[model samples]
Target: MKNDTPKVFKSIFALFVVAIFMIGLFYAFVSMPKGWGVNVNNRVSRLYILKNVRTATRLLDSGKFFAKGMKPLRAEVPYKPIKFKKTANLEDGAANVVTSIVVDYRGFDTLGEVTVLFLAASGVMMLLFGKRVKPKRKKTEPSLIMYVGTRIAFAVIFLFGIYIFVHGHLTPGGGFPGGAVIASGILGLFLGRNGYTPNHAGLKVFESLSGIAFVIIGLIGLFSVKSFLANFLPTGIIGNLYSAGFISLIYIAIGMKVGSELAAVVDSMIGDTKEEWS
Candidate 1:
């Protein structure tokens, strides 16, 4: 009864706080400048309409399907399709704008998101599964074809993942996809082998080092450029293999961290299953 009383009080207090927050938010919104929410000129829609018209006019006049170096006709448009098209390549050195946006513009947010993912994975492992136990099982060797095929596939998949992350600045794929691919490759090995146990120490070391490297790189950026995860290194030529400066480096770190973390998760799940079976 005493415990229930405290819980009831806590719930009531929480509801009160939420109500106060909502009232404050409503007041703030209503207190804003007049016509702030309404779109009079509708700049965004106008820009889109203008762009389409201009493109169609160019095609009709020149009798060509493609228009090269087509600049925005409107000087006072509120929104531009490519926000930093002119300076993105020069500033971030990434051929892909998505890479520039993720690693250069909103890097701190990405770091927080990655941290959250890692924490969620850890929490799931710890809370859902209390302790890990090794279950004794009959020793059985995998088929010759299965063993050989998995070995070859593992190497290829891992290398491909590395390639994806390394070329993230110039390509469509990035750290997250590459890391997932690598983790999937590792998972393949676990499924193929009977008593394959992932090296927890090695994975931990890789995860720790990559995480530390990411922080160190961010710290370096902070010290040099006065911003966290700022592009401190030289931005090489765009569309080149060795370009994008810190963006590629950060992607590499992210790939390693995510890959190791996911691999650890798979190992934990597998261990839990083994314990349950025993």
Candidate 2:
């Protein structure tokens, strides 16, 4: 009863704090500036809403809002020194500006993101170490149907992943999504094949080599162009397979590194689980 008293008090206190927080949040939301809220009757507000609706309708009908020879919308005080869309292809040689930004203009940030992902994968393995205990029972083999289907699907999925990363400069997919897709294919193998296991040494080698290559490419840019991760190579023709200069190369490196790292993580996790069941 004494121990229960503290628990009850703690629960009540938590609920009270949550209630206070909710009230404050609601008050702040309601206290926002009047002009920010919907005003159907206001003349200026109606005109602004009608303008947005017309613009949206036009975009929906034409499948585009901006066209050649039309003046682009701009803020009274523009922030960027150079417009992004105007120079994206010229600067990075990528048809997809989003890819150009992710793999070229803001490449160092992407490198940091890759580092974080690698660390997370490594951390999972490290944290789960020494906790694996092999069971004293024999493991059963996977069904023939499952094994055959997985084998066929694995190749297709891996090829699709390769295609996504290879054409990232010209398409919607990039290194991160492509690597994740490749890792998913490896995971399918882990689940469907009874005796299949990823080669840890090979994954490590690939991961290390890819990471080193990315840094080396960045260093080359720094030395030759006075900028880290600068587009040192010729951009080539836009939308071509060989276009986008160093963007595709960096994305390839990132794809390899991420795919290997994630595959290693899945391997470690599945291996530990298999050991526990063994």
TM-score of each: 0.66, 0.70
lDDT (tens digit, per residue) of candidate 1 on 1-278? 75466778899999999999999999998966566576534343442322233444455477443343445433333332433234343545787766777787778989998999889888867755654555667477778788779889999999999999999988899999999999999998987877688888999899999999999999999999898888887776667777768988999999999999999888777764423422
User: What is the C-alpha local distance difference test score of each model?
Assistant: 0.77, 0.76
Clash totals in order: 0, 1
Which 10 consecutive residues of model 2 have the lowest summed lDDT?
73-82
Model 1 stretches astray by more than 4 angstroms: 1-89, 128-132, 136-141, 273-278
Alpha carbon deviation, residue 36, candidate 2 (Å): 11
lDDT of 2: 0.76
Cα RMSD for candidate 2?
A: 10.4
Model 2 Cα lDDT, one tens digit per residue, 40-121 = 4433233222223334445546845444334443111122232324433343467776787787767899989989998899
RMSD of each: 11.9, 10.4
